[model samples]
Target: MIDETAEQLRERVAVELERARARTALLTDAVDDDDLIRQHSPLMSPLVWDLAHVGNQEELWLVRDVGGRDPVRHDIDELYDAFKHVRADRPQLPLLGPAEARGYVATVRDKVLDLLGGVPFEGRRLTTDGFAFGMIVQHEQQHDETMLATHQLRVGPAALNAPPPPPAGARVAGEVLVPGGPFTMGTSTEAWALDNERPAHVVDVPAFFIDAACVTNREYARFIAEGGYSQPRWWSEDGWRHRMEADLTAPMHWQRDGDGWAYTRFGRTEPVNPDEPVVHVCCYEAQAYAAWAGKRLPTEAEWEKAARFDPATGRSRRYPWGDESPSAHRANLGQRHLAPAPAGAYPDGASPLGVHQLIGDVWEWTSSDFVGYPGFAAFPYREYSEVFFGPKYKVLRGGSFGTDAAACRGTFRNWDFPIRRQIFSGFRCARDAEPV
Candidate 1:
């Protein structure tokens, strides 16, 4: 970032900001006004709330903070204040309707782009290397993904469409060996990295074997076939209790289709694709499945090392493939596909240790709680990550198909309650290495 010239950074920031807005448009425009306003599920916000909130954030951060311009809509600040309101209760508030939300975001975007055309890229921490702009872009992309999940939950016809991901390329190795050693975790220098991913640190992990790609639907089906879910031995006390209470017999949106199973994706029901990585399984489910298969979920540090470490050079990469940016050919990101590409679809995207599909497809559950690393400090604000740091949330590494490249990186961190299943999540298994 420091090496890039002012013009280069501006162009990059503009492109990212535009990309995020374009996606927001696609997700919201596909649904009607009523659909946007309806609360599809208690767990997610109404589409209209998301639309206006995106604009509110842009106005608060860019239009006011970095640009030093007056508030664009100060009166509506509390209406969209996420901390003040909860997701289930947001619809009862007087949120901007569909058309009004669209207009507000458009107005904010126009001002932001105008400011970007001349805003200096140096001085303040927020402005340095255009980090604030990057933060806004990531925040918007994250919401866009949330909106995509809402579409999945909405009760209606298929409101969105996209060609399926590519088929599997070759017979990828089932698992790969990651030799035990200390490697760098998180980021210290990567531009646009969020507050929690800062102040890079080293973690010494024991040698372990991890799935080369994510655990595929075909692989997960085996666990189901063997009556994995019915057994309590594979499940922990909490997971067993939750399973009994929820009566969760299968992954969300899955149902018995005669002798096999079918899955509902964005309102379209079809036979589950055997070769694609299994999604919508909560951390508890993943943990149970791993136990049934005689394996365990990787630790957060192990997941990062497998995705970033290069044994030959003893240096971590910015992504699984290399330092290059993500693209259609490299990863299944940015809503380019409605579903995960078949396992082993992107051969070139494999990490140095031959781990495939680590970048995009599904967020892999890890066996670690969300907490700050040593020497951690809250920068700018504490709400973004600090508030959620505890044993309540488990870490999820990697990114999903709905995730945008701007919001994901090898060092990026995502955490959620272990019981959440509606989000597009999946897992891979790991096992201790043999005696040295």
Candidate 2:
């Protein structure tokens, strides 16, 4: 998936722009002037600033940084170059007002697109500037998600898509039984894997049972109703403390309204669509729920084993269904611009072991911390792994609904701060082998 073609890159950028445009529209309508002023503080930028920032970063990195284009505005280099300094220092800068800043952003995006249309994609030097374009696309993608998260935080639940009604059929909860065997656990050379996924090697794993599907809202609610939130015994020390400090009684978007639970999703508040996968939960929350269910989150290795067929082969696949790219019907991505699709919507996209939606819909939580593979090395973006290899972060596999399929692969690993739940994140569970 990493070795995406130029056309794929262009399409990805266009889709991201559409997502940004939609979220911007929502923020514009939802945010009052006071809210806008508050959103502009050092902690977080206003929605207007966020929109402009996405456009500016794309233009600065792709157009000016790579294409050698002139700046659309003289002060752009000084007023809004977020990459020029430490990220923490960004919010403290003197920023432009909403109207002019937004206009400049629109101009920059148009110019960048025009430049992209003219540039030769295949033979150019894949230099710092070239990498910058990829980074900017990913950066804007991240902001699109953040905009949704902040909007939910500020304005209650919203769906990234139309919430499909609850699952019509009976829920199937079981595990895919894996036989004991030797597996090539690490990444291989066939794909554009990060350095952390390199130095591929073989690993032998014992027989295990993994969940057939990601943990669902219905299942998690049973835990909650059974005093899962009140019981410290179900939580790890870190998880317990996290709950106490945050006073989190439910998932980030979850709230109670009478006997049933409701969650803020995709720009609207709706009932906890019981059949949908439980989403936007942080690592600790997912862990706690797994514990409550008398199970554990799958290790990154286990997750990869389930999602990937031949680890040693290093077969580059965009989705678990093979080298095929994403489609609306294959999974819950890019469909009418919403949050999550129903868990079972993508039977055709299932892994060989029948793991549904492994590559799209939501990022699945893994038990493994984000560390380098055996014999790790660094690449051009040196900070990609070294700075985040510490204990606090964890690996998340499978791309979310908002991610481009090209960026989602068997070996394509994504890491996140354990407690950061701003993205469209969710989890599945695994359990020890049952006694014969």
Candidate 3:
């Protein structure tokens, strides 16, 4: 195992914290106060609320929890407490304006950085391994993603832009077979892994065939052309109800234009690219597409096994491409493209079994509910994961282009309601392997 020294770890933590702050700035700086305070959708907090909430969390964890300092702004704690206020109601609260929010986070960050320089690296799980620092960075980056979602939902002109992802290389047609076997499912030793992914365990999975790449716009278009939305047989009862109630004809921001499809992305309207992964799709949509294709969404176990299990080594890797960490060439991440790379774009990032784009491009919905593993225990707080353990939420594996590497891992778990389509989400299908 590679040993990271205290200084090395501290520098790494500092860099990640700064990167998170930079992303936050990039997302917020491009918008005006009106955009910041306005709630784009009932499901999301006002951008200003997220801005202040980021500071409040950093102050709570680093300034108060780790530093043992008095509260910086005790009066506003209730205002920014996420559990205390729902997204729709946040705009009604007296949130700090954009300038004030930026100043508040800056002050909080300065103190946190100071504390981090001297914090011991050997005591208390929260402080040890620089977990508190890492957690703060992850928290900020998550809010960055949420803010980006807000941007996507906003009605204004494009507020952000990046060069397009490199053109996809040769497409690997068809599915890869994951041999039947038990493989490590989660992580017991990933220092910064969240509570939900803790205490790695082995899971025995039957042989299955999973898509080599995420289902793309071209593939999904076939479902639409085949009257996927009109066919009740392809959708679950609840899923069909939600679809009918919403009257969704295509994925969010999509519309039939003449004989083709057009989509609004980051406030720009363009023809749908057939080769890119189909994103902004809800789990219900994924399920419907899978059903239409005579396949199924891979279960969480099957998805993880395909991404991490190595047949030759009989061990699991930290990432699909053997754990070396993500880069521009390996995966499309960190809002580098503001969109998914074309399907089959990152051959270098394929999993041991040659499953491509498993780490990035988009968050792939899985056919599993959000639940705790056996022997699970809530850490630091229960609200993080314990409270959400149930069938009410569906799981999404892998990370999206907006995801930070610090917060993403093979074991990282993301969950949401089955009907949520505003996130950057997509899916790849799977099926039982045929008997020899």
Q: Which 10-residue window of candidate 3 scores lowest in summed lDDT?
A: 164-173
Question: What TM-score would every model get versus the actual structure?
Answer: 0.98, 0.80, 0.99
Model 2 residue 212 lDDT? 77
Q: Is candidate 1 or candidate 3 better by lDDT?
A: 1
lDDT of each: 0.92, 0.68, 0.91
How accurate locally is residue 67 in candidate 1, as Cα lDDT from 0 to 100?
83
Worst 10 residues of 2 by lDDT: 163-172
Superior by lDDT: candidate 1 or candidate 2: 1
Segments in model 3 whose C-alpha atoms lie over 4 Å from true places: none
What's the CA RMSD for each of the models? 1.0, 4.4, 0.9
Instruction: Please write out the lDDT profile of model 1 over residues 1-436, one tens digit for every residue.
Output: 3478889889889899999999999999998898989999999999999999989999999999988898878999999999999999999998888988888899998899889977877778888889899999999999999999999999979999999998888678578999999999988898789989987998998999999988888888999999988999999999999998999898899999999999989989999998899999999999999999899999999999999999999888899898888888889998999998888899989998899989888999999999998888887789999999999999998999999999999999999999999888999999999996
Total clashing pairs for each candidate: 0, 16, 0
What tens digits encode model 2's per-residue C-alpha lDDT throughout 106-163? Answer: 7877777677655655555443223445555556656655565555556533323454
Clashing pairs in 1: none
Candidates in descending lDDT order:
1, 3, 2
TM-score order of candidates, top first: 3, 1, 2
* Candidate 3 per-residue lDDT over residues 1-436, each given as its tens digit: 2579999998898899899998898999898889989999998999999999999999999999999888888889999999999999999898888888888989988888888878898869888888888788888988899998999999979889999998888577699999998999899888888899988998999999999999999999999999999999999999999999999789888888789999998989999999999999999999999998999999999999988998999999999999788888888888998889998889998987889999988999999999998778888789989999899999999999989887788899999999999999999999999999
Worst 10 residues of 1 by lDDT: 1-10
Model 3 lDDT at residue 117: 77
Q: Which candidate achieves the best lDDT against the true structure?
A: 1
